[model samples]
Target: MIEHPMIETDRLILRKVTLDDAKDMFDYLSDSEVVKHMGIAPYQTVEAVHEEVEWYHSILKEQTGIRWGITLKNSDKVIGSCGFLNRNGKHFRTEVGFELNKEYWGKGVAREALEAVVTFGFKHMKLERIEALIEPGNISSQNLVEKIGFVKEGLLRHYEYTCGKFDDLFIYSFLKGDKTNRKSEH
Candidate 1:
């Protein structure tokens, strides 16, 4: 499989990351509050961000995974990232992850990018299902997934550890032909 290349959406241009993106990455990932629920430590330095960017850059050629920068078409500003990771078994399934700059929260940016990514997952990648494991207490993420039609299957008891404690997770999945994605292909 080739890399999951850059993809465009109605309101966004999802581009593959580069080492050049270190500054942009650090602007968001270095914040403690931003990564509190993300299960990753707050990036401690620009060099750490650079290393992450480098990892994303390398993963493309390896055909192993994908991460894209979420750039608003109108602004061309790198607002966040959304990607598929932990791929397994000829890419039959994988988990999705995303993070947005706090300022853009509640402005529909996540929904816009998510719609595009979900469509890409089904159409371009030939995925059977894409899962979004969101923290149980993260009402904001739950609402976003619901708006996009990801069914809340249930909770996984102490599913993941984040911020140094066991966290409950809401299991949301979008199988191909799921009704919640009606507006995505638009």
Candidate 2:
């Protein structure tokens, strides 16, 4: 089984999500603005969030992926979640995904959490490449990925079907020896 370790940053804690986190997860995930670029629709109920958390746990048990609940160092409230999705252990590659509460936007919290997650993926999970797929209209997320040193590869036509329609996506990637990954060592 893959061990899910809690990762800490200067101001945030990234740890396993629990059933108790449903309310917090639902708080942000229910926002249309937040789920706009995501594959899933805005959560309608806390029960739905509970189901989602259960799914996250199942994925961890299967060793398919790991999703960490992001919280402030001094609080138990989950402000967001970030982690590797579609992890391919044999190829040492995975897709990175994260979402933060709208209230926490523009505070650099997402960037800090992502940096720690990326570092953990490379150093602990031994990932060779971390990729991100973002909607063309999500400029904020696009900027965030680029800011973290992921190179924009190309636009994938009709890459994902979300919110009842097919959407194009931009693919960004970070390799093992990339300068940003190297700098993450410290």
Candidate 3:
């Protein structure tokens, strides 16, 4: 089994998610605005959130990926999550995904958490490429990735079908050893 480590930032903790976090996960996952560009429908029940949490566990067991619950340093409340998924060991690459509670938006919490995750992907997982697939309309996410040094790699038309329709996605990537991969002055 792949060991999951707790990653700490100045104001947040990236720890292994547990079923106890269901309510907190539901808070953001249930928000339509939070999940608007994620393709998945907003969760409608805590039970669904439990399953989502279980998926986090399964990925680790299968050695496919890792997901962490993002919590404030002063509280256990999970305001968001950031992690690597769709990992291709043979190719030394993986996809990154993250979401934050609306209440914490624009606070740099996601960036801090994501930077930690990206570090883990490159250092711990020894991945060479970290890709982020985001909907074209998700300007916030686009800006976040760009600020972190991911270069825009054009678009993938009708790449995903969700919420009853197909949506296009913009692909962005951060490769290992990129100068911008280090702590940014911003």
Candidate closest to the true structure, highest TM-score = 3
Off by over 4 Å in 3: 184-186
Tens digits of per-residue lDDT, candidate 2, 56-162, equal 78878877788999999999899999988888899999999999999999999999999888988888889999999999999999999898889999999998877
For residue 153, what is the lDDT in candidate 2? 97
Q: State, as a TM-score between 0 and 1, how close model 2 is to the true structure.
A: 0.95
Question: What are the per-residue Cα lDDT tens digits for candidate 1 across 12-88?
Answer: 89987766677777888988777877888999887888877766667655645578899888866677898777656
Each prediction's whole-model lDDT (CA): 0.79, 0.90, 0.90
How do the predictions measure up, each by TM-score? 0.88, 0.95, 0.96
Flag the better candidate by TM-score, 2 or 3. Answer: 3
What stretches of model 2 exceed 4 Å from their correct place? 181-183
Candidate 3, residues 27-79, lDDT tens digits: the string is: 99999999999898999998899998999999888877899999999999999
Decide which is better by TM-score, 1 or 3.
3
Pairs that clash in candidate 1:
none
What's the alpha carbon RMSD for model 3?
1.6
Q: What is the lDDT of residue 173 in candidate 2?
A: 97
